[model samples]
Target: MSATHARKKPFLRLATAAVAMVAALGMAACSGGASTSSSSSSSAQVGDRSPEQIKEAGEIVIGIFSDKAPFGYIDADGKPAGYDVVYGDRIAADLGVTAKYVPVDAAARTEVLASNKVDITLANFTVTPERAEKVDFANPYFKVSLGVVSPTSAEITDVSQLAGKTLIVTKGTTAEAYFEANHPEVKLQKYDQYSDAYQALEDGRGDAFSTDNTEVIAWAIQHPGFSVGIKSLGETSYIAAAVKKGNTALLDWLNNQLVELGQENFFHKDYEQTLAPVYGDAATPDDLVVEGGVDTTSTN
Candidate 1:
């Protein structure tokens, strides 16, 4: 399909899915008593006291991305700055503990949590069935969907258009699985980092790059000639913090914090302050940006 037609088709489908997902999430919130993470420990003590205990230990180590911008990145001054870092700070502050950031990559997040390398993970972890079965996720904080990007010279525009073309993606990401299951004919080039995959795309190593639309759009804006051809793909979910399994006390605390922060439009403010610069006026969904607490549940 041509770029023009590909753009039109997916947007229509995404619009439909967005509406349904929103309605379902809204209902889940109203019902309450959603399934809590099974990791909650029977012996885990709760209440504000938990945070107090952490603070007495002096610092809380958080896992975050060192290169993923607007979410987590080491700024020019050699300090972490981004939406996730900001949120991580807030969490530490609420816990009355000093926050220490541990830079992590895509493949190491789960291992870091499992090995207790970090007290919490603030990386851009998308909540999925497979991941949930391993690590426990807090309530949804930020929502994002996959996007297709290519140089302005390329004519590709949709998932189907890449049926026989090479597509680059970061290794161990949902994009790889999405294409493998839905568009198996598309040739894939996997890399370990976003920078590598994006550079490969710029160097003509692949016809296109696929990732969370938020990240792709940000990258395209930073580069002059590249553009995000397809903005939204399917029903990608929100980014949440993950803790080791059997840490229910920490999980509950994080979920409650998310809801409290949402009520005050913390995430909307976060986007405007951090992401809006790269995205401009037309970047995010108004509902998503302004969405007050989302339901923390296991259902759709």
Candidate 2:
């Protein structure tokens, strides 16, 4: 070979060898990275826990209101105590797990479930089509309708009275949605917490407060100077346990649990124990309770 060609051949071979080494290293790094990623993804935990997983872990996280009395609340003992808590306890027991209660705000009900913060929400969660899009609702366990409570001195008996007055409402509740959609003329003073909304009403910041009929009635009974003027508003809605969307195992468990509990009249027993003291003659099981996920309103 010519001297020039001979010199070029060795340089080309060296360049080829260097390129091969770099390619091999690149392939090795890519393969290692892919293996590590696959392993990590398989081991990482995500999404809502299954019924089997909850039982295996020995605990089920339940979201409930810590302020809404007669339905869900923290009692004098500083423990979760109310109608929802009573039912939550039974649900945990039936599932062979401990119930860990988490206080959830009105607007965060669906969020808590979607974020996997709670396995079930029993916070008097009213069934609505919009909420159903984000979460799966179990068969209803209780019945409710909107109720407006106002001061005895200036009680608002009709929706017409609210045209110019500010009506207090807990944000993310059906009452807020109802009034906003139907009575836009009525200005609303919204609070994130039930306690805050009631406080606003008591402070005269708003002429009236609206929420679940069962809740307002119970609250009105306990408070001396307030009365539920509008006992029922909008369509009757049912309260049910909710799970993250696509959690079929947990949803099915809740539905089946309601049916099984119905056999023993579990909710009636719950009402008698948790709500009876507060509601007394103001409400009855037939009025607020749903047995076996069945709505007896039509039959009655």
Candidate 3:
């Protein structure tokens, strides 16, 4: 199988089963305007310097997903290669620093950044109020919507159909929080890693799997027997790089970089070059693909 095909096949089977369960149990419940504790009364203090200062430090370590395909993953040669990895390398190169890749899972992203294990987190993290309280987010570079996937044999159609069903989701993802607040009737099967939750779904553990629509669509395309039931369930949001709280200088630099890249349609080009093969004609407009800058204060 081709690399993309190999990467998506397994996820498709797993997602299909998990999504079915979510439908049966009901969608997750949603809480309006809920807030979490901030790291400090004042924004967490971080070093104030331009991008040049960070580069002069020799290397910029970026925390990235190690198993999620097309975002960040180890290639056949055992080197990190993915959309996030490509972006991280470009940022490092532009700053004249060596890019040191630190493999991180979903749950460890914030902790790694907080502890200074990595200078920045380029791990496809969704921007949410809960997370914003802990880490400073740069301008958003990409946007993705939530989607549900089910097996060919299942009858799930919309999010409402997920009443009282069991759904498998990767822990620490926006999908988890979204479902938890919106579909309280649905029982969630959470896993620390995507691979593990996906495996559980394949083993006849859940009814359906929930995640970004882009990811589900890619997986469905690779697996012939499965299909995405709810293509666009709700609001779409941008995915941004995470920096330590109160890192205004670094955050500002990243924001400027994003704005420049947006003006040149660099993110669109990256999507077309890296994501088009798997997504093909299914890709949406450039506006949906590129979200410009981050809005840290915005709740909606």
Candidate 4:
């Protein structure tokens, strides 16, 4: 676990135990796979990997979260597993290449792409104007807003309740930026990983934890003592895969793939398989999932 990266391995069919394992192990990072093309050498100043180059290499390197569950996380078999992992697999399969997962933190999503360390980032990355300037975002596949969870005994039901209390947030997330810009009175405690942010909340180091509403809802359901009192805060945003700036070939490929897959309602099916079970009756697909590349609700 001290190593920064977990070696690549194929996901197993029986991955039900991965959630508990990832929770226990604190989301182990996965190492980047070797590039097959000279243009892809991480040591060199390279452009994003094109679809042809990836297919030629027989693998596509993807950046994803190794800690956040339902969306992205390491499975029991110690491989990348979760909704994004499943989607990444589909992307690779369609392109006739293997998926090489590189576990990433929220803050590192763009860095990995900018350095050509990862070809695509499917790490629950929300689209923002600032990030769009640094990376090219494909059409959105998911959407969300901010939400806050706190101990049920003293639940934070409203933003006004956070008057003098500390709020835990993962670094580089919309939640951190939103509070920093909108609510200066709220004390902020930041962690680089969602796992650590939740740990701070559990330890009573913060009055509440905030992040994507979808994530807080899932987490609150799993933890008996916590409740997501502020279910939705901030503007509705879309999550999409991102590539290095100006990587039009890869970006276009991703956008087209999303549209083609949308024709079959692929994302909704993905929800049934991965998210539905986790959410149970607490949530529904319509509340979240964006099918194909279309995001009717997106203001961005």
Q: Name the lDDT value of residue 235 in candidate 1.
A: 83
lDDT tens string, model 4, 31-147? 334335444444433336678877767777788887788788766666666889889999999999888777778998899998877788999999999999999999989889999
**Candidate 4: Cα lDDT at 219:** 76
Which of the two, 1 or 4, has more TM-score? 4
RMSD of 1: 12.5
Per-residue lDDT tens digits for candidate 1, residues 1-300, read 244343434333433343334334334323322222112323232221245455655456678776677577665444667889888998988887667677676877788877766778888888889888878888777778898999898846777789888999887787987888888899999987665786699799999999898888876666657888998997857788888877777888888887788778788788888877656755764534524347433255
By TM-score, who's the top model here?
Answer: 4
Candidates' C-alpha lDDT: 0.71, 0.79, 0.71, 0.81
Candidate 3 per-residue lDDT, tens place, 1-300, comes to 376567565445434443343222222111111121122213322233346555555456678776676677665445566778888987888788767676777888899878766778998988888899999988788788798887768846787777888888998887888998889988999998776766676676888898888777876777655678888876877799989888778888888888777677776677776777667777754635653574433467
Q: In candidate 3, residue 132 scores what lDDT?
A: 94
Clashes of 3: 35
Q: Once superposed on the true structure, which residue ranges of model 2 sit more than 4 Å away at CA?
A: 1-47
Looking at candidate 3, the ten consecutive residues that score lowest on lDDT are 28-37
Q: Please give the TM-score that candidate 3 achieves against the real structure.
A: 0.80
User: What lDDT would candidate 1 get against the real structure?
Assistant: 0.71
Off by over 4 Å in 3: 1-50, 285-287, 291-300
Candidate 4 regions off by >4 Å?
Answer: 1-47, 297-300
How does model 4 score by TM-score?
0.87
TM-score of each: 0.79, 0.84, 0.80, 0.87
